[model samples]
Each structure stands twice: as structure tokens, then as C-alpha cells.
Target: MESPIYLDNNATTPLAAEVVDAMAEAMRAGYANPASQHEAGRRARRVVEAARERIVELLGGQTGGRQPDRLIFTSGGTEANNLAMFGLARMAEDRYDGPHHLIASPVEHPSVARAADALACENWQVDHLEVDAQGVVELASLENLITDRTRLVTTMWGNNETGVLQPVAPLASLAASRGAMLHTDAVQAVGKIDVHFGNSQASSLAFTAHKFHGPLGIGGLLVRGDTQLAPQLFGGFQQAGLRPGTESVVLVAGLRTALELWHTERSARLQHLTSLRDRFEQQICAELPCAQVVAAGAERLPHTSNIAFRGVDRQALFLALDMAEVACSTGSACASGSSEPSGVLLAMGCSDEVVRGSLRFSFGAQTTPPEVAEAARRISKACKHLERQKHR
Candidate 1:
């Protein structure tokens, strides 16, 4: 059996060897609960704290004249995002004396979108900022949506599906000017792009290790020291009770290693992924003239490409590609196994036909030129075959 060409790095990345080693070593040497007071527990606590410092440094959270940000470890990006959205909203409700209004971009991940919807159901005014045709958030609409009642503006730093970079800094600045706190779902952007939480101006940001070649089941939410999140889980004194749980020293160690690798090799890895992505797009376009590159005019992540194969069924294309031993996705993995069209493309004003036929291909640091060539060939073949079957 041949190895499948994995092009779905946006969903998750294969663990780096160094990260795996770090996690394994931590598991062997530090198995005590980090909350305990014994020697073994102290070792575990040290591992967790060291990991936090590494991630803080990676995000530029430690700077002059300001205390280092607080990083609350969670199960993954979903939990981190939920803690940011719901936690921040709850904090706003406690401190303020008006209607609690929260805003999010239309193309946000399900975690943020659904959290906003939940808040709306609870009598909180929730607004979804509109986006332009390129999937970029409309600045004017954002400004128009902000009112005296708005307390939080939650936006994603980078879109998971289309890979289009959001104008988070300006958005954060706007929210700050309006006395609204800003939070960003930086899950897909943290390691793939240059993400400086200090400069982002967001009160809180979320990221997962799996998105950057670390272990699963571990991620962090970095909150500015001045920002407060009402405790979501309460049982222990861990993470200041915001996310109280037994810290997983092994996973945290892996996450730290992953961040270190990304911080060290970001430039070279970005260049490699960009070359693969560009070549893949050029070759695929040549193979299928009717295919449209989603958000072609927008600044996008170097590793991601979302393309629409006109007049072809996306599910059928996906199936055909799978048969060719190539792995990709129609959109966000959170929306996988659903028959619905991509919400991201729909939010971009793409026609139903285009949305139905779009697919996301994301490369990673380990993806090579040969893999890119093969993926393009397999995708072209699958699209052509699927188009013929559709006509038949």
C-alpha cells in the first residue's frame, strides 16, 4: 500500500519527531499531577511553566513594562475559543450595566460562530460582521455594528477554510477605541504566520498545538494580564480557576517544542510551503481552466489553497481523490461529514454552485515538491473524471 499524500494540514498536522520525543520523555519522567505538592509534582509543575514561557515568547507575550500574559491550557482549540468567547462575554456581563453585545466575523470557525449564536439565544445581542467578496471582513460594516452596548468583538486571525488573513489588528484597535474587548481565534494562524499577540492588540487569543505539528488534546489561550475571563471550570486552583484541571506536562512539553521549531524554522518552512502551494495552484489551473481560486486577490497563508472546480460535485471529487490516495478536505474539518455547502464560501458571497464545488488543500512543513506534483496530478484526474460522470 502506498502512502497517501496528505494535503489537509489546515485540519491537523502530523506530529514532529522532536515534539513526539519531548512528550514521550515528559510522560516517562514527569507523571505526577501538576497540582500536587510532592517532588514529582514539582517537576511536572516546572515542565508546565517552562512550556508556558516558551509559548509566551513565541507569541511575543513578554515585553517591556508589561507582565507576561497568562496562558490557560485547554483540551484543544475548540475549548480555548469557547473560553475566550463565552468567558469574555460572561465577564463583560458581570462588569458592565447594559445590554451585552458581542460581534464576530461571518467566516469565523464554528466554535466562535456557535458561541456567538448561543449568546444571542441567551438575550445577548450578537452581530456578525459582513465580509467582502474576497472573504475579507468589511471594515465599514464592523464600525457600523459597534455600539455603546457592544462589549466584545471576537474575530479569527486567519480563516481555517479559505486561509485568508483577517485584519485583526485594525479590528482590535477599533474595538479598543469603542471600549470593547477583542479576542481572536488564532488557531490556524499562530505558527503558520507571524503572530505577535502583543502587537495584535487582542485581549485574548487561542491556538492549538496540533495545528503546528505537536501533540493533540492540548492547546492554550493567552489572555492579557489585565483581561479577565470568568472561570469556566471550577474545581482546582489550576490556571487561576479559569480552566481548572490537571495539567498534562507531556502535551505541554510537546507544544513547547513545536512552538520552538516553528519559531526557529518559520522562514525556511514558509518558503517551502509557498513554493508547493504556488506550483500546485498553477498546475491545477492549467489542468482545469474553469476552476476558480477562492480569495485569489486576498492575502492568504502560504500553505493553503481553496479552489472551486466549476460544474463538478465536490463530494465526488473528494471521493475520487481519496481513491487516488490523496487526502484533502472540502472545507473546515469541523464541518466534515456534513452535506452542507461551505459556510465560509457562502459568507464570501460565492454562488451556491461554486460553494458546493470548492475544496481546501493545505500543505505543511514536511510536504515536498514531489508530493505537490502528485497531489496536483491526482486532483486534476479526479476532477476530470468527476466532471465526465456529472455530464453522464
Candidate 2:
């Protein structure tokens, strides 16, 4: 039997060899809790802080002087996004009067979308910016959406389902002009794109290491200088008392090693992933004319390809591909097993058939040309098999 092909990288990436090795070494040398008071703790604290400070620099943020951007570590992107939604909103609660206003997109990940829903439940005026058929949010709606009461504007930098890149910089600039801050969920965008936080002008950004070939359970929220964030979790003085907890030096080591490895070959990785994705998509479409790539007109992440099969059921094709050992997805991994059509696609005005037939195939750093070619053939075969079965 041939080796299996794995292309569901947008869900989560396998840890890099260097990241795993660094994490192992950190467990041996810096296993002490960062919050402890002794020398061992200080060593652990140094390890954690090193990752944090480097993240600020890697993401094109500032440090030192009167005010510097801060990176607050968290469990992952979910927690960081929740913190940004709740922390920033409440941070200005005491000083500002009247109902809080927030602007978000209908296509945000469950974390940000649910956070917005939670805020709406609290009597806050939450308005969602509409998205086009390609899953790109309307920038025109934003200028009108911002009023005197608007506090924060939130959107994802790269969509997980369609892989479409959002207009974040211009959105951030528009939001800033209205005295509102922008918070981008850069979980999928950070490693795949040239995401410069300072140049973007977003007040806060959320990202996790697992999305970028690093370990799970560790991520950071970069908050711009002069932007005050209220504490989301209450505990000790760790992470400037914002997300207080005992830091994981081992995981931080994995994150540090992962970022360093990407910096070594960012451009090459981007070009490689783009080439692989294009090859795969072209092969898929040519072999099966029934297939159409979603958001084909929009700029997308290099590693992701969401394609819709015209007359096939997504779940049926997904199961067939899985049995064929070709890994893929119907939509966001977070919303798996729900049996419902993708909300992201629905918000983009995709028809019931298009939404039901879409499958997301995301390549990774380790994906090879042979694997992509084989996977494309396998997918084509699976769809044809399902088509024959339906007729029978």
C-alpha cells in the first residue's frame, strides 16, 4: 500500500522537527514555572519572555521608549480572540458612557463570531459587515458602520474555509480614523502572509503556534502600545497580569523555534506552497470539470484550496476520500461533525448546492509534489465513484 496523503493543514499543522527538538531541550533545562521566585523560575521566565519579545519583533511590532507593544500569551487563538473581544471592550467601560458599539464580519471564525454574539447579548450594539460572494467583507459598509459609539472593529486576516485574505490594513485605517481600534484574528495569516502588525495599524492581533508548524496550546495576542487591555483572566502577575498563569517554557521553546525556522525561509515556503496549491487545483479542475474553486477571484492563503463539486454531496465525497486515504475537510475543523452547511459559505451567498459540495484542501510545509499529484487523482476517482453510486 502507498503512504497516505495528508492535506488538512489549515485545521492544524504537524510540529516541525526543530520545534520538537527545542521543546524537548526546554523541558530539560527550563521546566520550572515562570511565576516562581527562585533562580530556576527566573530561567524559565527568561525562556518565556524570549519567545514573547521575539514574537513582537517577528510580527513587525515595536518595543521600548515611552510605550511598546505587548504580547500576552494564551492557550491558543481561541482564548486570545476571546480576550481581545472582552478585554478591549471592557477596558474602556468605566470611562466611556452609554452602550458599547462593535463592528465585525459575518464570516469570522466561531471564536470571534461567538464572542460578538456574547457581546450582543449584553446589550452592546454589534453590527456585522456583509461579505461578498467570495467571502471578502465589504469595506464600504465599514465607513458607514463606524459612529461615535464604536469601540472595536474585528475581522479575520485570512479565512479558514475559503482561504480568502481580508482587507485588514485598510479596515484598520478606517477604524482608526473613527477612534475605533481594529483586532485581527491572524491565526491563519501570520505565517502564510506578510503580516506586519505595525504596518497594519491594528491595535490587537491573535495568532497561535500550531497554525504555523509550532506546538499546540501556546499562542499570543499582540496589543499595540497605549492601548489598555483589561484583564480577561484573574490570577497572578504573569503576562503583565493580563492573562495571568504559570507560563509553559517548553511550549514557548517550540514556538520560538518554529518562528525562527519560518524566518529562515519565509519567501521560499510561500512560493512552494503556492506552487503546490496551484498544481493541485489545476489537476483537480482539469480531471473533474464538475469542480470549481471557491473564492477563485480573491487573493488567498498559499496553502489552502477550497473547491466545490457541482453535483456531489460534500460529506459523501469526504468519506470516500478518507477511505481512499486522501485527507481533506468539508469546512472549518472547528465546526466539524455538525452536519449543517458551512456558515461561512452561507454568509458569502453560496447556493445550497455549492455550500454542500465544497471541500477544503490545505497543504503544509512538508507537502510534496508527488503527494499533491496522488491526492488530486485520488479525489477525482473518489468523486467519480460516488457519482456512479448515486446513479445506481
- Where model 2 places Cα greater than 4 Å from the true spot, the runs are none
Off by over 4 Å in 1: 63-67
Could you tell me every candidate's TM-score relative to the true structure?
Answer: 0.97, 0.98
lDDT of 2 by residue, 211-321 (tens): 889999998899999899999889788888999888888888888888888888899999999999999999999999889999999999999999999899999999988
lDDT of each: 0.89, 0.90
- CA shift of 40, model 2, Å: 1.7
lDDT of 2: 0.90
Error of 1 at 24 (Å): 1.6
Q: Candidate 2: deviation at residue 221, Å? A: 0.5
TM-score of 1: 0.97
